[model samples]
Target chain A: MSVKLTEDMLKALPDSRGHFGAFGGRFVSETLMDSLMTLEREYLRLKEDPEFQATFDKDLADYVGRPSPLYFAERLTREAGGAQIWLKREDLNHTGAHKVNNTIGQALLASFLGKKRVIAETGAGQHGVATATVCARLGLECHVFMGSEDVKRQSLNVYRMKLLGATVHSVESGTKTLKDAMNDAMRDWVANVDDTFYIIGTVAGPHPYPLLVRDFQSVIGRELREQSVAQAGRLPDALVACVGGGSNAIGMFYPFLGDESVQLYGVEAGGLGIDSGQHAAPLCAGRPGVLHGNRTYLMEDENGQIAGTHSVSAGLDYPGVGPEHAWLKDIGRANYVSVTDEEALDGFRKLTRIEGIMPALESAHAVAYGLKLAATMDKDQVLVINVSGRGDKDIHTIAQLDGIEI
Target chain B: MSRIEGVLKALKSQGRKALIPFVTAGDPHPDETVALMHALVAAGSDIIELGVPFSDPMADGPVIQLACERALKHGTSLRRVIAMVKEFRETDTETPVVLMGYLNPMEAMGYETFADAAADAGIDGILTVDLPPEEADEVAPLFAARNLDPIFLLAPTTTDERIRAISEHSSGYVYYVSIKGVTGSASIDVDEVARKVAHVHELTALPVGVGFGIRDAETAAAVGRVSDGVIVGSVLVDTIARHQTDPKALHQALTDLLNPMRKALDSLAQ
Candidate 1:
């Protein structure tokens, strides 16, 4: 099932009311509507302004080291014996991930809005470190809410955030993971709406956020498009990215939405497997419901309570996906798939051994699925997978899994 | 008139303020919830706000979050909560019972089905914590068609425009969250609350009930002095949590907790 990729269809999304079809409305309390409205208006005005775009571009070039190379994984393609695979190296960014691109954009927005303080929620701590990095650069107060469970697991990133002059709050709530951190952050934003700006890490949250985060992160796909044309001389046959709140995937997919020939595949965390009921593949197994200020696909029980999600990667262990992903799934524009932890571990090892690149476990989901997809296609077919982040933060988890103390 | 409106009107005619007590259904035990409601009404609760347990209550603080967790452990759900209300209405139909919860459960049950079932089970009104007026368009009409009051919340941070918009859509009464924070977070200034309640009154003719910081009788009475109703939640829910293993003790503790606030509110009117 294919829908026509029209320019108007892509541009008119999230409407004036922040809805993407029946998804992505402002489902927050009245206390939050005013701030959201203010943000939407300011973002709309500044998004078109030359000064904002120039500053953002300059930072991407000088600070974040933008135009990251789309490298051809020649050895992996030969090993797979099928399609040629290309890697969009977002892993090479300043904070070792694509998360910094978004934090930088939002921190600048926070400064423009005259907000002295910024708060964010994170699961893997990449976003937290990125937010802390940008806040330190801009001299704004930063607070990061991480689930207590993640705090214990991702201690190195926690220390890095603190060293960068940001306070790390360990939230002890329901399930004590990404979802809980988000709840705490939302509560804080509601309480401190006067001076604080909530820089949501992913393309989830309520309206304007999904749209804003997508626009800010779209630098990935925009660059990918030009590089693919210059390098491969045409768009790749397929694009693959792992989905965790879908920021990186949407960033990589948005600019190419109009390219009807470029097939999009979003891989979700399949923990054990989708049928195991422990995975975080909401679009594959869950239904639509309201959560985290947006109506989106969610892993909820029959009684409507959010179910606990499991994934080897902390970043993907959330029960809900971004609303736009839900819309994309509904419209049949993007194919949503999954990779189990075992398969992702295999992908991680294969990439490291073959390409000398240790991909983040979250990104390995895409790598894992990309390999299978490549093996089914002709050798001339090119596929680009978003290497969204590096694996330095997951070394401890990997070592522990392999029975190494460190 | 609906039960909530009738109760508010009756209290207004008597020159008295309403003291609403809140308790999560199936907290101590599911079977004991009906008795607890009876005890609250008998101890001078003009209305009962029965909390339907949800896994994630973002607007709630530690006390109520724990209450929700405890209730969820017992497998309490929206349907079970309506059943509890049905049992309570068997003997006492005079006091209004409002279902207080988050929106997901209702959305899961289907809005029309939930509204019809709620009205059938003797629910007078609903206060969905996260469903602001902007997103309440679909469910609001269903609730109204069932004669159920679709209540909304007004926070300290709510702007004048939003206040008027909420007032226009809200029925029965508007809940004035006295603090900018979540439930059971901090103390509120009585003078500031009086000023804000006055502002709310000026915008909407609906009676404003103040909540979210009234932990003791003095604070409840102070807020009740300015608002038409006083809602005491976390404190009463905390008391129930303390005596959760003993249903009789929980009932006695709830009565002891609310009786003082009831007397304080009545004394204010006097």
Candidate 2:
């Protein structure tokens, strides 16, 4: 069953109370409520100001390298013998992922709000590196919270964050992963709300965070709008992107929401299989509940305790997804599916061999689903896949899985 | 009148401050929670705040976090916690029991169902640490219909406008967090707490209870001098953690820990 949405519902979402059709609301403690309201007001003001937009545009162009190429993968299209595949190369950004796009925008907002320090939480550490990079560029003190398990698994990114002059705190709480890291980050924000700004890595969290992040990251979709017209002669017939906390996917899907002809697919990490109960595909399998700060689809047990999630890619190993994605799924604006670890591995290898491009493990989930979807479509159709990040961080894990020591 | 309102009225008439003690249900052991509640009342506790253990407690420090972990290891759930309260009410119906925890477990139970079960189990009040007045529209009406007191937290950094809003939405006494940080954190400034309590009194007539960092009798007494009640949680929970192996010793230690603060609070009322 699909929910029918009015025109106003799609354009003016979240209303004034930060609710996206009961999926998103401020579910934080009273201490953090004031700060969130303040941030919401400031973000609303800055999003419409031309000066702020100008600064954001200039940073995207010169600092982080915007308008990344929309490349046609001829060999992969030929090998699949299906729809022609186009890649949005977000991997070539400054910090090597689509995460920096929002961080740059938020870091600028933090400066404009006169906050001297910024804090973030990370799972695979891509977000930590991106936040540290922007904070370093803007001359702000940065703190990144990572789970102790992730700190060990992604040690190189930990060092990279430190090299950029950001302090890294290893959270030793529940599950010791992305969820715990986000909890600790919220705790830190509550404690230091006077001088600190929290730069959430994804389009999740309470209220204005989802709205603000989508607006900042919508630059990807805006650029795609222009690029698709110029390069592909029109909008692609379909769009595909991986969903962790759903930032990159929402960024790629927001501008195309009104394009009824373009089909959207969001691929989630199917760690083992749907029946195995080890996947992080919340939208595909989980139920709606309150977690973190918002009411969204969450992987939780019967008693409402957040269940431990498994994904070969650390970035996608989260229990809850962004609330807007939950809304989109409910309203039938987008389709959500999953790809198993082995399928993603196959995608990684096929992209590397056929197109000479190394896709991140997180983005490989999208590639896997895209190939499957393309094979079922006509050969003349166009499918655009978001290469959300580079694969440099996953080399060690991939090598270990392949029975090689590096 | 409700047990909570009655207790506050009696305490005020007797020129005494309320001594509220917090303990996680099923901590140390699942079967001993009722006996612990009785022991707390015997140790001069005016109200009992029973913690429903959750996997993630963002506002809590190491001590309370460890308490929740120990309770969860015993497979404690919100339903079991309510049953414990029901068991406690069988022997003693005078002492008001407040259920306190995060919002997820109750949310999973559904607002109307949880509220009916909680009232049926003889629960007097509830304080969800993460649910502010802004997000209480769904659950607050159900609580009011059941005549359950909906308590809220007021931090040191809360603004005047928000304080007024919280005062309107809240039914039971407002919990004033003594410090800006999480529970069990150190460095409590008594004068600052007094000023904030005075400001809170100016906004609302509801009784204000100071909590979060009152570990010893001295701090409890100092806080008691300004607020209507002093809530001690981490110190008592830490005592339970220390005597996890010996239930008898745990009971004695909890009583011993609360007796002095109880005496100190009484002397302050004098």
Model 2 per-residue lDDT tens digits across residues B64-137 = 88888888889888999999999999999999999999998998888898999999999999999988888899
| lDDT of each residue in B126-153, candidate 1, tens digit only | 9998888888889988998999998899
**Model 1 clashing residue pairs (backbone):** none
**Candidate number with greatest DockQ:** 1
Give the DockQ of candidate 2.
0.74
Question: Which candidate leads the pack in lDDT?
Answer: 1
TM-score of decoy 2: 0.98
Taking candidate 1, what TM-score does its chain B reach relative to the real chain B?
0.98
Q: How far is candidate 2 from the true structure (C-alpha RMSD, Å)?
A: 1.2
Question: Model 1, which residues run further than 4 Å from truth?
Answer: none
Q: What tens-digit string does per-residue lDDT give for candidate 2 at A1-406? A: 4544556667788888888887988888888888888999999999899999999999999999998889999998887789989999999999899999999999999999999999999999999999999999999999999999889888889999999999999999888999999989988887788999999999899888999999888988889988988988888899999999999999999988888888999999999998999999999999988877899999988777788999999899999999999989998889999999999999999999899899999999999998989888888898999999999988888999999999
- The lowest-lDDT stretch of 10 consecutive residues in candidate 1 chain B is B247-256
DockQ of every candidate structure: 0.76, 0.74
